[model samples]
Target: MERRILFTIMLTSFLTPFAGSALNLALPSLGEAYGASPAALGWVLGSFLLAAIVVLLPFGKLADRYGKRRFFIMGNGIFALTSLLAAFAPNLPLLLAARAAQGIGSAMTFATSMSILTLVIPKERRGWAMGWNVAVVYTGLTLGPVAGGFLNYYYGWPSIFIVLAMIGGTAFLAARRFLQEEWYEDTSPHWDKKGAVLYGGAILLIIYGLSQLNSQPLAPGLLLGGLVLFFLFCRYELRQENPLLPITLLQGNLPFSLSCLAALLNYCGTFAASFLLSLYLQSILGMTSRSAGLILLSQPIIMALLSPLMGKLSDKYAPTKLAALGMAVISAGLAGFALTIHNLALWLMIPMLIITGTGFALFAAPNNNAIMSAVEKKHYGLAASLLSSTRLVGQVLSVALMNLILSLSWDGLSLQETLLQNLQLALLFFALLSGLGVIPAKVRQ
Candidate 1:
């Protein structure tokens, strides 16, 4: 019964992220079909990710106020509706709106998923359970391209959304049966309505500002204005009694904070590769969508197979050491792939992507465990949201930084080659920045 309940919670939690990421691989297809410019395309992607994180804090409180299972089902139901709308969207504006709606549901899903787990999972087994949760969380990213590949190859992009809707519907049904209704226990402050508006505004403005990087000339004046808004957001957040993020948690534990940094670094380097490299394989290497998906399968395939064992090992070994080892391996793989990848054989890219994929998978559970374990149980809900927000920020920055580099040095090369060069540099930077996280890892909890 416990396992059934946990599985239901995870399924509800991860369904949106999985679907969103899976749909990402098809962006170029969507762009071409809908005649979207690069800026519009960025917005298409950015809108979803941006809204998901920004809304998390508010929805988290709502989940606490109402029953988690109630909000969980409601969010998934909305996700299914928005996904269906996205499949039928005829114009770019409609698509953008639908994606934003999807993002809201996604944010709700992410916050409540972790909170429900905290409500149910015993602390002693959380480390191991977190491994499976991590694995499930990424299940979409791993399977998405493969599924997108087959669907886009034969069916069309709409099929992907239909599949996601069906999956979400199934999860909703499962939730109703397996989950119990738990009322809120905390006498925490009233939901921070003002905080939500301020945070959401700041994040959207910042993401919009970054999206303007390649499309519009960088206007220092406008960027300064956005920065001002960002600063005000921080000040606003600090004043809230039950802050969206428990800011105090940052100072409480070294391993927890540092582990988040490590994840940011790993994710910054790892996630960018998939985005940039997909273009490389399809345009530069002249491969089919299916072939690109299959070739890229190396990364997630290795992670899926090896991540569980590495997670188990983390039970015995120091998690910090495990993280460091993984990052070192990733650094080596990225550097080698950057230097060596040229007119390569089909079989070659697999080994390089696989090595780093294994590195990332090995690092994930240990890092999440380190972060969650370092914090008190009482703070798990907000802490979980913050951890995800941290990761999303890193991801957004990576995309913006990679694009800025590409635009600066573009010498009339095709988009594919330019994309590769940009990512090569991004990977190097990701590796260097990841080392910074090690400082906090050395401190014992």
Candidate 2:
């Protein structure tokens, strides 16, 4: 049972985030084949995001009601299927649709991974096990860019999906052969359909509004409409006994809100770095696609190597402090990145990349430990649900905001000049956001 759970968790844990981050490196390739406009490209990026956000909490609840193992196995199969579909897609719209289906699979994988980890690991040892789990999650981010670049270049873009599907399929088969059902049916709670819809609507509106940051400001009506829907969603959640993002999750003595804020700001920096830096290297640095991929490799390389070490540390220390320190270091790294823009050498940038990756690795597991560890055992599902949702909010807005900000200064600039100038300015803001997260981490302390 333990081996079964471990294999499934490790596999799906990486797949969910991998699905999202893989596209970053593949975008240039995808654009060439489909001749996609930025907005159309944005939809390709967003399709998985929107689905993951909408279904994450619901799926978490489903795991609690049914069985985590069940969802893990089934969702892996779904992920495998959708990945194959995505690889074979001939048009942009069809590709986006396939990605959207992939999102459902992603949510299922994430929700189940968290639930299974929480339930399977002992309390005394959970922190360490979860730290390891969290490390694997970050490992996905580290692997995706390198893998995406290589596959797209060698085998074409379709190979990305084909490879991911095979991985997911292997995990599914492993789970089926060895995993056992852990849930004993302790009277499942009432399904909060209305609350679920309300929360989903609110989250979607919020993300949509954020995505528009790359475009013109939201019309007064749309902004007003989103705010109203959000307010109503809050009111509805508080009123319901059974809720998706139960108000109690926030209103209780948990550090939920502050932790979420910290996560958002931290991820904003890294996500911005991931999304923008690739274009910058290719365009401004006058590098080929392969070389650009190599340059961008520094960040994730350090991240993958150091995250497991950071995870072990989280088991002993308060995660908030680690998280804050990590953010501070990342801020410094970004500052270095901005300052050294024109010089841009890989070896020269190694220190900054290492620092940034270390900071993120330090911040990632501990923040997760802080959030999940702080919440009640019974609400593990809710807590895990919220974690995935916050990640959604962070990543979705990060890309959109990148577009919005880059468009401001990059208007009519050559791709090289546009990416260089845009990344410089955006990273400064990204640093500021990360630096500000110290306040929340301090509050948690």
Candidate 3:
């Protein structure tokens, strides 16, 4: 039963990230097919992330009140359905909408999967279980670019969506067959509608505003409005008996708060690496999608292999220290990329990717263990949700920053030159951002 539950959880974990990483390889193809701009291609990715962030906390709270297994199953179904719809989308608008709906499903699954694992696994083996879970996620990322590239080269970009639908369906079936238990912290019927609206609205406004910074005159206003709404959301949540987020967790718990902050910084710094690289390889260097995907495999392959080992180590050592060390390595890797961007060679790029991947593997599983371990069992769902939310928020910021750079620097230069400049600036900024995370990671209890 334990093995079956782990397998089921792992299957669900693989699907969303596979789609995300794979889509990076497909972006140039997608842009050419739709005659879309770089910002628009960024939206294809950001829309899904934004939607997932909006629903994650609410779904996490709701899963705690209702049942996680139920939401997990529903998420799989919605993801599969949306993938099918996205495959047939004739226009970019329809495709973005479908991807947004898919994000809601991803939120459901992301909010619940780790909580379920934490509930069923014993303390001694918890890190090991989490390790394998993180491993499969890296595995998905490892395969996505290769498979997505191959499919896009042969059958077109729509085939990637078709493959995602099949994977989602398979995961849905596995969950139905293997997961028999339902887990929930409370059986409450009361809902926090106001808190939900404020949280979701704030995230939407902020992300949308950030994405529009290069084009919109009112972007700053929208950003300020979003911050105001977020403040209101936090205040309202503090007053509520059943808040969307557990405010105390952030305010009172040192380890959990710092761990979350480290996660946010790490993701913000690193998540855009692939996005920038894909464009650099294909658009700047004129490599085919297949070739670019193969080159990109160096990072996640190392991550997939090393994550399980790091996870097991976290069981016996100080996870915070491991996480802090990992963040420093990631900063070094990003700095390597920044320094080498002007005259990059495969030998240099591959080594940097390997270093970055190693850092990610070291950081991901242990940081996850730290976050989940710091919280009580009852807040597992919320903790998982918050972790996922932090990741999405960072990812959104990373992409938005990339889009902003691409938008600002595209003038008066060739496309290749523009991309090179963007990559250089972005890598430097990310390296500095990642370096700052080490302090919080080291200080966290």
Q: By TM-score, who's the top model here? A: 3
State the lDDT at 316 in candidate 3.
92
Backbone clashes, candidate 2: 1
Candidate 2 accuracy as TM-score = 0.90
- For candidate 3, write residues 1-445 as lDDT tens digits: 9888899889889998899888877999889988999878887887898899889999999988889999999999899999999999998999999999999999999999999998888877788888899999999988887788789999999999999999899989988988898887966668798999999999889988887887899998998999999999999989988788769769999999999999999999998888788777787777886688789888888998999899999999989999999999999999998898888565677999999999998899999999999999889998999999999889878877877766655669886687788888988989999999999998885
What's each prediction's TM-score?
Answer: 0.88, 0.90, 0.93
Worst 10 residues of 3 by lDDT: 402-411
Residue range 119-161, candidate 2, lDDT tens digits: 7876555656666676677778767877777787789889989
Off by over 4 Å in 1: 28-35, 183-185, 218-223, 282-286, 342-348, 410-423, 443-445
Residue 85 displacement (Å), model 3 = 2.0
Quote model 1's TM-score.
0.88
lDDT agreement of model 3 with the native: 0.89
Better of 1 and 2 by TM-score: 2
